[model samples]
Target: MSGYPDNPSGHMSGSARTRRADAQRNRERILQAARELVHEPGELKLHTVAKACGIGQGTLYRHFPTREDLLAEVYRREVEDLVAAAPRLLETHPPLDALAAWFDRVAAYARVKRDIFAAVEAATWQDLAAHSLGPIGAAVELLLAAGRSAGGVRADAEARDVIILISWLSRLDDTELDARGPRLLSILVNGLRAHHRD
Candidate 1:
């Protein structure tokens, strides 16, 4: 609660309160429509997306300002999802398996990106590449640390290295599917294990 806002939401002038509520509703709808399409990154039609969100196309534009802006937001949220899932996986699975499962989730997510999020621009991908790293890196570091403490993960595995490896793994096609992920994660997990220590 340290940084919690005094409002715990947002300040609104009388004239803006109704508009703010409408905006919040539209934003929620947009986020819902955008969530499943986060990874695909292609075929995210704003007009159709608006319909899916139960809002008008104009409202979508009004809220998002532009397509690129919407895409950026959706990208940020997707990264958040991946990061958020880490703790849930750790809570439910054994350490190494949790790590492996998370890898599998991410690898599959790459396929989703191509269909929903649209063509990846060098600039956009660059932005995504840069911003997406921090949360995931932290999550992986935590997972590896947990695994290590549990005596299942290798000691020498660094979070930065893990992030790099996962970045490479994320570009794989659906044909590669779960095959490469589990195997690669196994080796990585072995490297993270205190016993292997390499």
Candidate 2:
């Protein structure tokens, strides 16, 4: 053999692995900071997010080259997370209860989306929504399917209809949401009961 250590696995060097892990941690931190900052009043500033995350602006830019890039990433991750929640919710709760819980999650997502829209251009917002529709619809369908199978939701209930019904949640002001959101969701859940007209 040559005057070198034997190499088998092609794994990265320890320093390289540490750098990769740090970059991933930084990306997550940036996302978390952006998510919170987007909800604050006025336009979102990249520098503010960098400051919040305790990273330099250049570091932030390396990860997200533009403001739109950062916002879109935040939006995409939120949609991904929301879609992933459906199956998890069903695992621990009854179908109808899981559906209700998912509705609440959707409301929270709506609030984040509202803030994202304010920060992003109309075109960017449209693009984000277009990409998000499929996954979000699938999540809703998953929850509905579980409920229907359990005889808790009406057989005729469609995911599209359920989406339309809850669309109003996005329009509610903070005050109205706090005052009426839970009651409205309760009525919605009750209305979707299997016994409700086919």
Candidate 3:
């Protein structure tokens, strides 16, 4: 027999596992860099993203073949994170506080999305919005359900209505959002309260 160790099972060897880990690290670095740079003032170029992440262009291209691909992944990951926060927040905080915190997350997401949508093609933006709507709405519903059960939120508060109420966040400029986001969010949250006066 050859000097190499025999492997009957299909599990990845140590070297293969290391390579996979390295690839995942590189991908995450790229995404993190892209997320930051996308908010900057100029056009987001692939080379700039690769450089910011300390990865070579070829490596970046291997992970994301086009700028649209990278942008789409970033947007999708943002939505995933936003959706995943609902359950975790509910587990840790009171229903009303969790709902308030989730709204904060939504405001952050809207900022990033507004910048990203400006960079991507209209078709890409449309596709991303279509795919994200259901999961995001569901996340809102989850938070609202918890609040309603706790008697902190109105039983009649619908996810779509909440969505519509917050949609204007995307239209605010960065300065305006910074100055007004918290107050606006507080108003929105209080409006959903079970005991709020008309």
lDDT of each structure?
A: 0.72, 0.90, 0.93
The list of candidate 3 runs beyond 4 A from truth reads 1-7, 196-198
Give a tens-digit lDDT track for model 1, residues 73-111. Answer: 766766788888899999999988888888777765555
Q: State the lDDT at 111 in candidate 1.
A: 53
- For candidate 3, the lDDT comes to 0.93
Best by TM-score: 3
1 or 3: which has the higher TM-score? 3
Each candidate's TM vs. the true structure?
Answer: 0.72, 0.91, 0.94
What is the C-alpha lDDT profile of model 2 across 53-135, one tens digit per residue? 99999999999999999999999999999999999999999999999999889888877787887789999999998999889
- Tens-place lDDT per residue, model 3, 111-159, is 9899999999999999999999999999999999999999999999999
The lowest-lDDT stretch of 10 consecutive residues in candidate 1 is: 111-120
TM-score of 3: 0.94
